[model samples]
Target: MRVDLHPFAGIGWPGRERCGPMRRCLPQLRDSRVGIFGVGSALAPHVSRQLDLLPALVPALEHGSPRERLARRIFDNACIDERRFCIPDFRHGTRKVLYDTLHPGLGRRMAVYRREAPRLAASACEPALKSARVAADEITHLVVVTCTGIFTPGPDVELAERLSLQSDVERTIVGFMGCSGAFHGMRVARRAALERNARVLLVCVELCSLHQRDEAGAGALVAQSIFADGATAVVLGAIRDHDRTLALLGEDRTCLEPGTRAALTWEMRDDGFAVRLSPELPSLVEGRVARFVTPLLDGIDPQVRPAWIVHPGGAAILRAVQRGLGLERDDLASAWSVLRRLGNTSSSAVLYVLEEALARLAVGAEGVMLGFGPGLTFEALRFQRGPGV
Candidate 1:
């Protein structure tokens, strides 16, 4: 195997002292054939269907203000039937714990994240390891991706210990990359496997509910209505004689759209993080979807329509992708089902849809996965189903 040395392999990078202890060598996975051996996901225990939760939220939002009206419209059109939350009180009608005078500080939110993220990661990882028929110590690397929480001794380290991985296993934490983070994680794992021939464990866990703000504005209300908590784990390695799952062949990412930099943003605040979502986000994506994505899709196969596994940013975002790709609604049934059941689990959203798609994907079927994030970026992965799941 050709092991590519990172730039700072032996000698630390300049200004390394200024960086935090959590910093490590950059992941140097290069282009190679990597098999996705297994995928497993876990949802928080607290669940609430939309029918019960939306009515309960009416009182928290203004009874008749424009924000309230906008929230009602957003929720009515959300197409999400239910979502799971790590916080018990956010379930359905129990709004007083979070919505009433509860401006949870950043510290409190981080505390919850530190406590819950590892458990969720473990819950997902265990099943994945089992499916891959691999043990904890056999994992040569651990990669954890998240956008909702920040803490030293972060989820990556915690998950490694929780799973009893080797003390010196290479580690990486791809943080704050927004909804598209999971795709980045997959790329990282693919590289690790292809470069060093290492089996990589990848986990993406987000507790978006922990960063909730009680603000009554359209952005806050809309974010609250759609975001939730979930985690997913996948085992990746170089394709071998025994490897027979979906193989990640290649990926494409688009440059940020002009003047749309701030369309979707996640910012840290003293009293938890604030989400700034533009109402025009759907339209912006729709306008550029074809131009940005058609080339990528055509590169995979000009004649065949690969299954479109899209990120469930929301109802509108999914529709925008569909219209952009000239795909029918039925083409996005898995994406819609994930959104309806799990809401947008931030970085885990696309993986959830991929898991649903994997179950029904037939051998010889081609696939295209897409995710959008803060850069107004679009990330796509092209893959083909192997003989076995």
Candidate 2:
């Protein structure tokens, strides 16, 4: 069975010390041949060059004009450049790099994914399926994780049938966990690994482009510019006898700073999931996330040769994590690319970083996976690469 687990990693407050005090423990983790799978997602409803979107861009709209300037300043601080989705403008950038889409963040449940899933699957999902297929003919379990859309009996069922997977393969759908939902899905898949003694596929797709909010004010504008759409699927399954396997180590969940609930919240709005982002998020993350990390990576090592898989929630969030974690400039290099390339794909974003870490980094590199969302919750994973020993 595969252990799809990352216990304590996030976009904020990533500490070099927290990444297991440095060095890939592949030499010590005991399991080195574990296999992990992934796909870089692409979604549609392509945003052709975004224009001067307001409302969501400025905060004063929500509270009125008394604080317009101050709100704009807050949004500006997020340090964003022009934001857009895969859609080409009247005639945008190169078609090869830029994805064509109508906007994945548009409709509700089925419509949203139905509208965008085909594109995402075509670009990201199909490849992941092939990667997994190289190793297993039968997918014992299918875990679909998403925060962007919801379909009554979700895409997992559809994907299973499409993949020629056995009808009896266990299916689990995790929805609306926001950007951190992949962690939750993987956590559940970890359990499925034990129960079924089988292969499992964990899919995380977030068409942030679809749920694009109007740039109401600075906060919304920064948010609108910063978040984009994408998806990633990781395959985790135990090798029959390989001791050095990519194994799902474990997972940890923490609810920190309860009073800050109003700071970060995602509510259903007619347009889509209108995110009620509070200014309190950054500082809140700075203050409480450190405590969460100390406990999660404790047993591994404390000397600090830790590797990191941070969610590219935003460049600011990455900064917040760096300042809090005492990490080096390269600590979150992968995360930055994900953001620069894909913006924020909601829940799927963090795992995208994890996928990068798994591919480029060597096995003994210690890693801490982290992501944040509503409920003022922080989900972390303490893990390292698989089977490369």
Candidate 3:
């Protein structure tokens, strides 16, 4: 019954200059006890390509030209040992390459997404429901998050069918928010739980590999080097007696860095979605993240150091956050570990980090989750380990 309410208690949305638009304050839900009860994740199983195989899989990286050499260096230092892909052609010796002189078009890529995303979602959701000790029929709400694909009768519908969720389950899709998509989904889940004591199932699935381009530009190189495929699911509801969970503390309004609308973007192109990440992104995040994040910690006891579950955008971004917050590498170990193990699975990445953090946190431990995406937007969630954890 000990609820920590300092972070978001009675905080209104910031002005347009600060947060992009006028908006109502997030509901404080002081009387409700929403919390994440279970976490599960699954990776695409078709191809597990190592960093060294990149030059072979993508001929553009094999050339010894200056741009290609630099791309190779980026690949080498990506902090990723291997990345899973739903596309089998991403492997080194595929008989038919998906990305030849002409890369796969958007339609083809989305076809793969439609086929694979639901299966991956179910793979993650099954374990999530099992761990939450909730049955499929008990779920009253479903929140699906993704940025890699889109089509009519999307993964949301397919996932419900695959999982045998109730036909009446209210569904919401948090799409195209990029890496922070899961945070939005979590927000929806929390709101539903608070409003109706709803049992909410949240799923994030990204097939970043489906959007790969053969271009040799810095942005393309970086995106290809770090992006991968995975899905993660979480079950949330009113905190139950004797339940071990990460109690939802509060969430900050989306902070859009001024004049950074173009710093990072995922845009649709004929050949799948094209990602453009400016080299200045790391420094931009480092310079502004502290200012944006400090308010959430305003009334927190200065002596208490909370765990950080950061989206692993890349090595540079992780190091920047560490330096900005003056945190030790150990503080962001889960982020780094996920990056090394799964590359950047976009929306699912932060939840993967959260899963890792959950295993290590002790009872009553508090943690902050940070995710950055398009709009150069920043999403922050504050949570604590509930009693009986």
TM-score-wise, the better of 1 and 2 is 1
lDDT of 2 by residue, 181-252 (tens): 888887787667655457777777676655654345545655765676666776666655543444345435
lDDT of 3 by residue, 141-220 (tens): 99999999998887889988999999999999999999889888988888888656579999999988777666877777
Candidate 3 pairs with clashing backbones: none
What's the lDDT for residue 4 in model 1? 27
TM-score of 2: 0.76
Separately for all candidates shown, the number of backbone clashes (residues 3 or more apart, or on different chains) is 1, 74, 0
Can you tell me which runs of candidate 2 are displaced by over 4 Å? 1-28, 31-112, 133-137, 243-248, 301-304
Off by over 4 Å in 1: 1-32, 54-60, 64-67, 92-101, 299-303
Show model 3 residue runs off by greater than 4 Å.
1-32, 47-49, 95-101, 240-243, 387-389
lDDT of 1 by residue, 48-163 (tens): 88656654444566567777777777787789888898877655445444444557577777887889889998999998888777888989988899999888877888888888
Rank by TM-score, highest first: 3, 1, 2
lDDT of each: 0.77, 0.61, 0.80
Each candidate structure's TM-score, on Cα atoms with residue i matched to residue i, is: 0.87, 0.76, 0.90
Shift in Å, residue 206, candidate 1: 0.5
lDDT of 1: 0.77
